[model samples]
Each structure stands twice: as C-alpha cells, then as structure tokens.
Target: MVQKYQSPVRVYKFPFEMVMAAYEKRFPTCPLIPVFLGSEVLSESASADGSTHVIERSCKLSVDAPRLLKKIAGVECVFFIQKNTLSWRDRTLLIEAHNETFASRVTVLETCSYSVHPDNESWTCFEQCASLDIKSFFGFENTVEKIAMKQYTANIKRGKEVIEYYLSELMSEGITEIPRWVPPAERSSPSKAASPPAAPSSEMPAAALAHQSPRLQMVSWGPDKLDADYIERYLGRLTPMQESCLIQLRGWLQETHKVKIPKDEHILRFLRARDFHIEKAKEMLCQSLTWRKQFQVDYILETWKPPSGLEEYYAGGWHHHDREGRPLYVLRLGQMDTKGLVKALGEEALLRQVLSINEEGQKRCEENTKIFGRPITSWTCLVDLEGLNMRHLWRPGVKALLRIIEVVEANYPETLGRLLIVRAPRVFPVLWTLVSPFINENTRQKFLVYSGNNYQGSGGLIDYIDKEIIPDFLGGDCLCQVPEGGQVPKSYYLTEELENLDHIRLWAETIYQSAQVSKGAPHEIMIEIVESSSVITWDFDILKGDMVFNIFHSKRTPQAVKREVSSSVPAVNNEQLIDRSWVLGVDYSIVESPLTCREGESIQGSHITRWPGIYILQWRACGPTHARVDEVLSSLQGSAPKCKVMYYTEVLASHDFRGSMTSLESCHSRFSQISVTTTSSSQSQDGSLISR
Candidate 1:
C-alpha cells in the first residue's frame, strides 16, 4: 500500500479482483475498461505470453512485479483503489498527488490494459524487481476492496475525460484526424471478427427485411476446435457433397406457393450440419435462383436464439450478413408461440400440432364416437381427385388447407389452425398419424370429389411443355398401340423415371443442368431390345420413393409387360391423380428448434417415399430474408417434366445410414429403387435395405 503523497494527482493500486468487482457494481450497463492482472490477449492456443514478470499465474498477476505490467507508463481509466477500501476523499487526494512526481512520458492507450497507476509501495517494488532482475518474482499480497458508491458516475467520468484529452491533444498539434471511439459511424455495431456483421435498421418497413435472406444470421460453432475462429474463416469452402445437396434444393420447389411459406422467422429454413454446413450448402442455392429469376441477393437468412439471457435479443435479432449489414439487410418474420395460442383459439376446439390423412389413416380413432369425437384436423377430408399439377397446385392446396382449417374450426374442437403438412394423395398424413399423435389424424378416409382436371388431349398433360422445358428428341406423339397387358413401347421415354430412379441418380453429371431444360426419357438408364422380344423387367418398387421415375417402352406391349410385373410385384402408391394434395408453388415448414439429426434414432419405421431423387428450390423469403428452401422434389425432373405428381417420405432415421449409400448413378439400369444389399451400417439389425 502506498503512503499519502503531498503533491496533486494521487495514484493508487488495488487487487485485480477488487477492481473488476467494483466495476461490475458501479457500471452494470456502461462499457468499462477491465483493469485485469496479467491480462493480455490470449494466444491462438490460449497460452499466456510471458509478458508478466510480476503476478504469478496461479491466483492473480504478481502483486509487486510486472505481472500485469507491459508498459512502464501508459494512462488508462482503471479501477483505482488506495488499498483495502480507501475513502473516496482520500482517492481524490492520491490522484492529485501522483500527477506531481515520480513519473514521466505516459501514453494513455484506449482501454486499461493493466491497472495503469500504481502507488509508491507498488512503484518501489516494480523498480526494485526490474533493477534487481528478479525472474522468480516475489511480493506481498493485499486483499483490497475497490469501491464506488456512485455507479455510472465513475466510468462515464473516465470515458468523457479520455475523449476530452484526445480532443485537446488534437487542438495542440493543429491537426485533425477523426477519433474512432465516438459513434460517428452509425447506430449498429459490428460483431466479433468471427461473427456475421449485424445489419443496421432501415428507415422504411420491409425496406431491408423484405429483400434479405435469412441465412446471414446463422452462425455455426464447429463441433470441434477445427472450425475455430481462425480456420473456418479461410478453409471452409463449399464441399462437393454440400454443393450437390444445394443443387437439389434449388429445384425442389420451383413452383411453391407463397401462402404455404412460414411467416415466422425461426420456422423457416434450417442450418444443417453433418451432410453439409448450411452456409456452404447455400452457395449453390443462391446460384440456382440466378438461373431462374433475373434478380437475386447474395446472402441468406440465419438466426440464433441464445439460451435465455445470453444475447440481448428476442426471437433473436434478424440481420443479413451478405448484403452489407444494414438496417436494409434485416428481414422480419412473425414469431409463433404455442403457449398463448390455445386460449386465443377458444376452448371449443382442440389444439393440434400436425395432421394426417389416408384411406386407412381415416380409421385411426373411430370418428363421431371417439373421446374427442372427430379430432380437430387440417382438412375437412383429404382430397384424392384429378386436377392441376403438383408443381402449380402445391401453394394453392396449402392456402386452401389453411382456409379449410380456419373456416371449419369455428364450432368444433378444431378451431386452432397453425400448420398444414402436405403430401401426395392421402398417404402422407396416413403415414403421418401413426408417427405424430398431437396433430389431427383422420382414420376414416374421406375426400371431397374434385373435378379439377382440364387436361384432355395428351394424357394428363395440360399443354405443350413450356418453351423453357421443350425437349429436343421426344416432342410429337407417335400413334402406336401396344397389346393389352404388354410392355410400353421402347420408343416411349420417361425422363423422370430414370433420373430419380434412386438417390444414386445424383451421380449423373448432367443433372445439375436440368434447371434450364425439361426432360423426356432417360436414354442412359434404358434396357435395350434383343433379337427376340426379350422381357426386360423392372418393378415399381425400385422406383417406389418417386425421387426418380421409371419410363419404359418395349417393342412389345407395355400393357402386357405391366400385367406380368403386376402379378409378381406389389405396386407402390405412385401418384396417379392430378388433384392429389401436393403443394405446387410454395411449401415451407416452421423449424422450431435447431433440427437435431442425432435425436432421429427413435423412429422405428421407414415410410415409403415415391420420390427417390432429391431436388432443391431457392427463393428469397419475403425480402432481405435470405431463405433458400432446401426442398426435395421428384428427382424426376429429368424424367417427367410434365408429371403432375411428386411424392417423398423419410423412411430411416438419419443414423441408419452410416453414410449416404444412395446409388444415384446406377439408378438408371437397376429396377430397384433401394438396394437390398446395402446395410444401414456396416452391421445392421434389420438388413434395412429394401429387398427387391
């Protein structure tokens, strides 16, 4: 402890612990410089630099030595305590006294690197330690309490004085350089070097939020140290796998409806790991939209809801990282909270999280007689009619479904309508009910008959495929008849069937180019005819999850060929009706939490998916919300450009596949959509591969 000095500008020293403690109590909200003991920027490996010769690394910095001292004399606004709770009146005298003697050439830097002013007792020790060249430094310790009766009065006084000192210094030099400390830039602040820059607020509404993608806000902390602050910034480029995943999502919902899109920010797209980092995956997503729409943004939306109290944000803060982080970069989506909803919905109806519909699914719990008779569901009845296209009808269907839920739920226990999950025909929800009970489930299958079909001329097609899709080889229909119960003629090509035959079709290099053109049939995935009309057979099971389509034509009769195959293979429910309940233009889901791919181990069943191939569609959410739908479309794009139907279902839990074993390449020739030989892991209990 230093003795009282006679001169003005007194200096004092206090324990670092005492300093921090006083500051927290004094300036709770005000940003104050930390007067830490032996505090220096940590090395990349978190190692301490041997800069501190005084404070020991064990408890705090060396008390008397240079443990916390890097400069001989640098001014800093740090917690100054004479020692062990000195009175404020005494501190004033000490500060005044110190300015008069024993020091020279002081350079006051930005923040306090170390407690800047040490009193005489500490000064003597510092001088002696340096003069005596004491490497194994030893000094007396003092338990001190740094106290400040008035809070912001202390830190604010310091900050203001520092500003005044700088302004005066500039005037003395007859020079002018704008000081960086002041808020001259703007209202928003930049995040850490590793974080996405937060966008500033816009003067207008949806001004910035309308055009920003949601992807910018997502910040992925690596599972290990490898994605550390320094490494990820440079090395984490989009991998090929990530690029492919993106390519698929870009095309998945080229025709989704806007109504089905989630209005809630959190429920939008996801930041996926394992398969590919969401950011890397989005690179391709952005380029995908460039091919379709002339106007597009570079960034996507990313939001993070910190565990309460960590971040000063609710529903988290929405900011766009790619679009020059500005208020113009933020996109706002409605927030959803389930807690207050049930009451607002009125107790007359039941609250449902999801709903399912199918012929068998309609009988889940006997309707009109069950406890909650006729459970509140999304649809009055799942419609299985013939109508518009899946690509075009998807959004309209969602709007219709939401409207149906809102309209009918008025009197019954179905008034609360928050979400609607769509799938082709009635199977999705039927498949949905057994898995999810909180949602509306229809066990008694019933659908309103819809005469929505307008396609009369060329089978189910509405018109000549758009110019964007018109194929080169297979336009004009050839009037050729096949014998009843015979195979389809070889001349008839089904592009979707071959391309999306299985996930392996992803191997086809030409697939990415599909975004620009429509398809006819797979010339690559074909079975040739022989001297004698040979029966080259393939079952629909191979193409069950319609990710790919199976278009086949034989010299003989497709009718005869199909009849023979029908006797041997049970048909998967491939979409037949045009009015099936599929979203066309817009489809989206609310992602309530960070999707846990790890928790997916509980699902025992693997539901059948007709769409075997995955495709992606990307669009800017509302505006500045950088949202790209990582949607899975019928990998059949190269197969059936005009097909009005598409379907998909995730059968196995993510862990079931040690790694994605989708033979997307061999999909063309093999009739099997799923390889029976491929095991979920090197060793699996179920031999889960679908046996053909």
Candidate 2:
C-alpha cells in the first residue's frame, strides 16, 4: 500500500520575494536539520530577463534507521534529486523531489510550492504533498514504510522552523526585503524602479517575528483546502498525518459524494475514531453518510417532534456546560420508568426521541463552541442512577436500549466527551454488562461510575461539573427541568397500535420515496405542470441494479391504475405511468436526454418546462432487451433483475425558479440542467458510484 501526506497551507507574513530568498538559503547545507548532509547543484539556468530561474541539485541525506536494517541494506546514506522552478513573473516557486537510491525497490516522491497569498499581497503561502511506495524491501516493507512515514512527519515542523531560522538570520542582518525581478528595459524606467528598502531600526525584532503565530490567509480555496488555523480553532489540534488523512478523505468525498458533504469537524471525528486510517475512516464515514441520507437525519432537529407523552416522561434533557465547556446532558435514568415509557410510546418513538436528543446535543455543542470561544465537538452526559434497578432491565426494554446503542455507536462516534454515572445501584452492573460491549472502546474509557455516596466528595462530580449548577435532585441548589419520569398510566399503553408497526416504516416518514424498477415494468411518476418555464427538480439515489432515467411530456394525462392491496403489507408504488400501447413520440415526447444511472449513484437535475401538461419521470432497468421468452421466464421464476431507487421531486413556479437555483447549484449535482431539445436516443451522463 502506498502512503500519502498533504500539509495544510502555511502562511508567512512576508513578501514572496523575501520568502523565496530564505528558501534558497536552505540549499548547500543547513545545520538546523541534522539529517540534511549537503546538496550540490547539478544544473542552473535563468531567462534573459531574469524573470524565470531553474535549478537541479543532488541532495544527500543520512537515513535514521536501525543499525541491523542499515547493515542489511548495505547503505548508510540515501540520495535524492531536487528540481526547483522559479517564476518571478508569477511570484511562485515549485519544488519536485524524488529518491535516487533503491529507486526500483522503493519510490518516494514529494512536491512543494510557494506562492503569493491570494488575499494579501505581502503574504506568502506554502503547501506540500508527498507519497511513499515500498514495493519490495527484503521482507521489511512494512517496517520501512512505518519508519519512513515517522521520519517524514517528524521533519514537517522542523522544515518550517528551518525556514523561519533563515528568515530571522536575514532580518538580523538588516535585509528586510528583496526587490522583485524585472526586465532590463523595465528596470531602466523611472516609474518601474523599486523603492528604497525599509531601515532596520523600523523593523520588528527577528526573534519576535519568527515566533509570532501564523495568520490564516483568507484565500478562496473553495471546499477542497483546509486552513491550518481553522482546523486548530474549530476542530482542535491534529498531527500532521492526521490532518493529511482528513484532507484526503474530504477530497475523496468531494469527488464522489458532492452533495450533502459533512462538515470538517464531523469528518475529523471519523478520522479520529479510525485512528487516521484513511481507508477505514472512509468506509465508516461513507456508511454513516448513507444512513443520514436514508433516514433524513440531517433534518431531525427540524422534522422530528417528540410525542407529548415522551416529552413529559423522557428522563433526559440538556442542562449546562461542564468544566471543559462541553454541553452537559442530565439523564435521570434511575428515576425514569423505562418499561412504562417503551410500552406507552413504542420502541420506535423512543428511538426517535433519542435521535432528536443527539441532534440537539450536536447543535448545542456548536453553539457552546462559539460561546466559549473554543472547539467543543462533544458533550458530557451525567446519569443520575440513584433509582436504577432490575425493573429498568426488562427484556423488551433492554433489547430496545441495545438497538439504540448500536445505532448511536455506529453513527455518532466520539460525540460523548464524558459519561458520569452517579449513585449507581447494585443492579447497575447487570445493565452495564448487557450494553458495555456495544459501546466503542474509546467511548467506554470516558465512562465514570460512582456508587452510593462515593459521588459527593472530592474526585467526583465536582471535579468535572461546577458545584452550583448540579441538579437539585443531586443535592445541589440548581433546579433541573428534565422530566421526572414515573410509571406510565395503563391507559397510555400502545399495545394494539404498535403491534403491526413495521420497523422500516418508523424511519420512512421522509420526503423521499422508494420504488422498485423491474424489467419491462418501469417505475415512474407523473408531474402536472400548469405554467410553462416552471422548474421541475428531482434528486434520487439508485440503490440497486443499473437503470435508465428519462423525462417525457404528454398533452394528455394517463389514467391511474387501482391495484388490490394486502392489509398486512404496505403498498410499494411501482406502477408504470405510460401505457404499453402508447407510442414513444406520438403519445409523449422526450423532453430531456436519457440518463443511465448505476447502483449507489445519486443524481440530481432540473428541467424548465417549455409547455404546460404532464411530465413522466421514469426509471427502467438496464439490460439486454432481446432475451428469449423462455430465458426471461426462467429468470423471473428464480429471481428477476430489478432496481431500487429512493427519489424526491418538486416543482417550482417561474417566479420561484431564480430563488431556488442557488440551492440547486450548491448541491453540486451531476446534471445541473437538461436541455429541452429531444434526442434520438438516451445517453449516459458522467456519474460516480457513492464511495463505500
């Protein structure tokens, strides 16, 4: 496996010319870097106008490896070829380097660039990326890769320090700036002549300038680049390699899942959860993203309203901040009647309540981060287990609790900063045994349990939470608004109401709808447009087999088909809107070109209606149309090829089209708009499968 690294943009509050001069001083030899032995120029060239310079050098470096490994490799030092291309006209420098020793066995490539900051003319920005590939290393490939990556990351900060040292040296010598390069003809012009340099007495101290905090340059990096200062200020500090993994994973998402990309803080959480393993983090994050989309989790705070019974009986609610500024949630688990609540509102209602709490907790965290002026990505939960007992561990309730734990662990990794359990009963151990295995190891370490009166004194709640804000029930003065849960009345039990509730239907109350597209019997919907030029927008994810999508406009409406329904099973609308006897062009004309969608791909697009009538959106399975009757019959008898799609569509008036366009563009849809002209046949648009 090849290892890669990317460094966030580092800004120097100095002109590009001065930064370039300091960078050049690092050549020949730099005592600050012990491993950098020396470098000799192989070739040098400059343009006639002195606006462009190119240099190639052979650098020698001592490898910091174990003695046994060095002896086995029969090498003490390695060589690398460094090439620099300086464009004074563009105010940029590009550096490329590659290892020379063991080129066939192991490959190391690095690229670095220094350019003028986009927003600040006086500032210079630096960025770097490198990759290491070890094909064969005498049965020590893994060890070599680990050692090489460790050394590389350890030197990342050192490289910046070296540049700062050179910069300080130059400043101490009264060289505060370097004149920009110019053509001979322009240099002679009085208007084009450079101004006199600033005096040394007017400049700040070199040491102070070198040690100052680096400012974040306000550059338009779009959504791809992550600023170092932003990361530190918003997502907390991360190692160089951790930052690289975050950037790489985010870049992959931007490339594949363009719509609804999670925030940087959210992405960082996944990276931390996986210990910065790119592939593992990517897999975990992709699964969570899909879950969020399928269940409409992103809008839970807005869409989910807990039942009145749950609001009054649920034992959990947000309180105040902990000592570390984390949002604190007080859950009176011991006092709450778990069995009564589950029996009253059903397990699905309880699960939805929990999800809403999590969503609200995350929002509170963001708000607290701004209020506290620090990064608060997780929250603290204080469980008042004074009333916990065997009744709380009822079989059905335990099963429901386990399911909730599994969902939260998989989707909300690393969100719990601390879990404080106070006044635990003797039976708490039994409950813990049933659920602790489902919790993540990282999260489990944050659990703090205190039984009996052990939580009152030092090294207890006071150490993590403020004394005054402790709930009144916990012997503190502050009053908590969390619902005082009790045994629900028998009249509230939803026995008959929940007996036939489908698990899938619990989360199916979303704006999106699912359809099954099979061979010949295509799934489609009809949209009635009363005004021309109105916008018809559609977003859908192909969840199964490959299928083709097309839009057709008809002057006449198709009759709705009424089918027999089974009371036990919910209906799946897979009806074909277009009749089989109707001809393609006569009955309905294709308004947009056909788009071939593959499994796991999400497609969003819009079309402006040229005429008012009916629009049919269709998804048909893709396969050979000439299969033999017997072969098709045999396949159908066994398992027919089918496609599943989750889709949502909306129509906007002509006046509303302009207002919604911004949102449509921001979604990064593959097909932003479709031309109204009809095509002879459908063609597949460029699309990528959702990353797993």
Candidate 3:
C-alpha cells in the first residue's frame, strides 16, 4: 500500500518499525540501498499543546525530518530514504543521500558535523542544519546497514542448508540461490542482470501494484501514517511474489487462503509472530518441505459420537463433525459423591443405582440453555477423542485463559462480559480429551474439565463441584483398585440408575446432540455396529510454529512416487502397527525431481536451496488402501492426482498381526467409509448399553 503525499511529507512513524516499512513502501519492488543508522527507538516528542510530535532531543539521530527531506530533493534524485546519526543540535547536520542514477548506485555520504557536541552530554542541544555536518551521519548509517545486511545474508546461507536437506530428500534436484543475493562486485552487474528501476508513477493500473479495496490508501507506504494492521497484511496483499511463495510453501491451500488481508494490518505483526520477523527471508525458500503424514484435520466440531449415554445430554445432540456443524460445548456437572449428597441435590434414582448418586447421572441436562448466564452449545460427534490440554495456546492455563478472555472481550466485543464455563460431567471428559492432542505433555496430564464455576483445584470439574456442596460429582478411590484392565473403567456405570436416572439423562442429551453442524474442528466420528455406535473423533489444528509445525501440516500425495509395499507386506505387530500403519499413514509420499536418498562423504549441491519437498493435498475424506484398494492404489499411485484405496478390517487398539491387515488397516484407514452420520440410537435396546 502506498501513500499519496499531499505535501512532500517528512513524518516519522512510531514503534520504531516504519523505518524499514517506509522505504519498502515508497520504493515498491525497486532495488534501494537501505541504510541503517543506529539501534534505538526514535520517538518524536511533542510539546503539551502540539498538534504533532517534533523531532526532539530525545530522538537518536536528531536531524529534523523536513531539512533531511529538502536535501534529497535538492539532489534532483529519486532516493527513497534519508537518515541521520547526529542532531542539527551539534552545529552540524548528519546526512546521507542515495545517488539514484542507478539501482544500488555508487553512493557516498557528505558529512557536515562541525561544532559537534561531544557524544556524552548532560544538556539538551540543537545546532541548525547549515551549521551542522550531515554527511558523517550518512556514512555511519550506511556502514551499519551494510553490516546488518551482510549478517542477514550470512544467516540466509545457514537456513539454506535446512531447506536443501529436506528438498534433496524428495526432489533431489539442486537448489540454487537467487541471483540478486550476490554483491555487485561478485554478481553480474546491470549489464548482466537487469536491475532496472520500477515505474515511478503511482498512476499505474491497480493490477500493476495489486488489487486494493477502495478504502486502502495505495499510493505510498508512509510508516507514520499507516496503521499497524495495514502493515501486517501489507506484505500479504502484494501480488505475484506473495502468491507465488504461498503456492510453494502452502501448496494446495492457495485456493482457500488467497490472502484476504484485513484492513489496517499490524505493522509489527511479524515481530512476536513466527520466525522473529524474518518473513522476507522465509518466503524465498528453495525447496518444498517434507511432512511425515498427510495430516488431515477438519475445523468445526463434527464427529458427533457422544460417549455412550451422553449424546442426548448435549445441546446440538451429536452433530457429525463438519465445517458447518453447530457448536455443543460440554460442561462437566459435578458435586460430592458422598451418600447423603444425592438425597439433597440428586433425584430419587440416587437411592437405587449403586447406593450412590452422581450429578452426572442425576442432573437434568438443559440443552443449549443460557445457564449461568452463558450461551454454550456442546456439539456431539462420534469422535475418537484422544485428549486435549488447555496448556496449548488455544485452551491455555488460567493466566492464558484470562488473557484469552480479555482478548475475546477486546477483539470479539459481543462475547464480552460473558462467563464461559463447562458444568456437566459428560461435557468435561470430552473437552479434556478433545484438546489433548494439541497441548504439551504436562498440560495433557493436567487437563481440567469445564465445570462452569470459578473455583480451582486439581481434579476434573467433578472435583470442583464436589467441594461446593455434597456436589453429587465424582472419582475413583486411591486404593490399588485397578480394573481388570489397566485403562480408566469407562465401561462401568457408577451413577444412580435405579429410578431410570441414567435413562432419562440419555434421552435428553441424545435429542440435544442431534442439533446442528459447527464450523470448527470435527471432534468426533461415529459408525454404527448393530445398535451400538462406535465413535472416533478428529482434532483440527493449524500448526503456527516454524519447521516442526510447518512440515507436519504440509502434505504431498504419492501421485508422483508410488510403491508396491502395501500388499506382499506381512502383518504388523502392535509396535509395527504404530509405525507402519497409523504412524506412517498407509499412503506414500512423493520425492520430487531430486530423488530422496542417503548422503555420501562427497559433497553434492543437490540439497542447495529447497527447505523441504512437501506438497499438500486438499482432501476432504480419505483412508488407507484396503487389500482390494491396495491393488488400485498401487496401480494408480503415480498415475492419478489422488487415489482412494480400500482395506480389510482389523481390531487395532492392540495388534493387527493376526494376518488380518484388512482389519488393521480398517482400524487406521484414512476414512472408514465412516458414515459419521446420525442413526436411530439404541436407547430402546434390550440391555442398558450406555456407559456412565
């Protein structure tokens, strides 16, 4: 975005970022020798009644902006930047000028510091422009900028290694540096490489720069005048180069994320964001990235398989996890489980079930109600919830949570003053498990339930409710009372069941889960087997980190590199299953022009530039190639842009080595042809099949 100078503007932007942004804006794709003066935040101070801040004594390089501007204009050159190292206060004007006769033209500074106040002084000082030495400022600033650019260039070399290694592993083709990186002395000069100046006129067509919203000021980029948000999305808005880099780094995501930048983008958005603000460098990677699996994640709470008996307890019932699914946030209802607790808070069924009453089973679930004055809709899907820990940024710790709340209020105004808490037993377990895969390990272990209240402690929401009243909430005893199996005994019904409390609760929540689809990560996937529906859930995530997260999410189909290893492959033991099937994902990845291979002692430049060789596939639903599907995938791997294979079914929690690769693959296939659809629940089945 550019600014139309109503006046030959001499304004300096704050937050110290405009220095670089200003140059880029004014020059726009033109090669300019950007000179840096000093490392400091230069704030133009203001008198109490001032309309604008002046270049004050507090500024690092104190030359007045107006005087600096006139000098460059007098030179009759199109120099994009001017900076100073000393104030006109020293009876000297520190100044530097770019000789725009050529791009990266032969340049030098004309220092004019005369009666220089010593560097260390106790008093405020100001020397007029005519009485000051300005050339020295240019010299010092240029030297610093050159040194910094050199360091930055060196770091880029180091980064190249990572990109090359991954890319060479796949494409095997040599990665080369872009020609502009070399210094003029070492590089082919303009005679060899065209470093021509870009069009100076802003009257160029919108397409010449890029499409812009009518509201966006696109004439020039004045760092001072530009909002921070505008700066953030500015780079994204740039065409060709930006879009091209996206295709390389993001691959298939280009269609959906075609850079719909927001208005008034953040000027310093990249500082605390990914890569420490090295976005300029990252965009120029040489190779495609490599990812372990074709990671598939759907945003929107979809997979609607609610825990047995809890489906009816939610607001949205068990809407299949989909982009448009309505939300159903689970609230773990809890209270103390002591004998007398039920008599007070629990219903009569408490006396019959297990001689005990639990709020999870006793309480009536109010579907999508504004209970506690909060609007929360828990979406249900038959998802295989591994886990969720708020420790991850999304569901962070209390401190982070508080910050999130504040952000919500500040950014999402409508959500302000709303207290969001989950206060239901069935709700808490799902919330914890859903967020588990994304959080840190410690956070995963400490995953807390959404019990809706503000009291704090270690246990799940039940623990919070337990202390509040004989809270009819819940846990297992500390004795070595391990169930027959070592896992948490989710199969046992420990709540009051006599008065049909469990049955009633089930009927209510099932109706709730049947509500709507949400546009969030699908939390569950369920398939029916007779009257019982088996549920599997998927967690959605966009890795916001460099390297690990980047590669993990990038995908490349094996369309270019097919292998015949699925069949003729022996069955896998539990451990092998972890690595070969679920871990490796049944599909194969492609190694591009540069064949992925083992390295030798001799050095080869094949891994020269690419960061990684990953290619993302935009797939909606898919699963591993079944034994029958295997033959099809094998034949089509390198032929089709995409291939869907079929596999036999196997029990996969433990071992798939029983010669039933079909069954094993079934357990871990990309998609089980998984209906993930709602069906007539077995609430009316003969046996009480629901697990409390």
Q: Pick the candidate with the highest TM-score.
A: 2
Candidate 2 residue 159 C-alpha distance from true site, Å: 1.5
What are the lDDT figures for the candidates, one per model? 0.21, 0.74, 0.23
TM-score to native of every candidate shown:
0.17, 0.83, 0.22
**Candidate 1 at residue 629, lDDT?**
16
**Model 2 lDDT per residue over 154-263, tens place:** 77767677778889989999989788766576677877776322211100111110111111121123356777778888888888888878888887777556656788
| lDDT comparing candidate 3 with the true structure | 0.23
Winner on lDDT between 1 and 2 is 2
- Superposed model 3: Cα runs more than 4 Å off: 1-102, 105-295, 299-304, 309-692
What is the Cα-based lDDT of residue 175 in candidate 2? 89
Separately for all candidates shown, the number of backbone clashes (residues 3 or more apart, or on different chains) is: 129, 0, 149
The Cα error of candidate 2 at residue 359, in Å, is 1.3
Predicted structure with the largest lDDT when compared to the true one: 2
Q: Which ranking of candidates, highest lDDT first?
A: 2, 3, 1
1 against 3, candidate with superior lDDT? 3
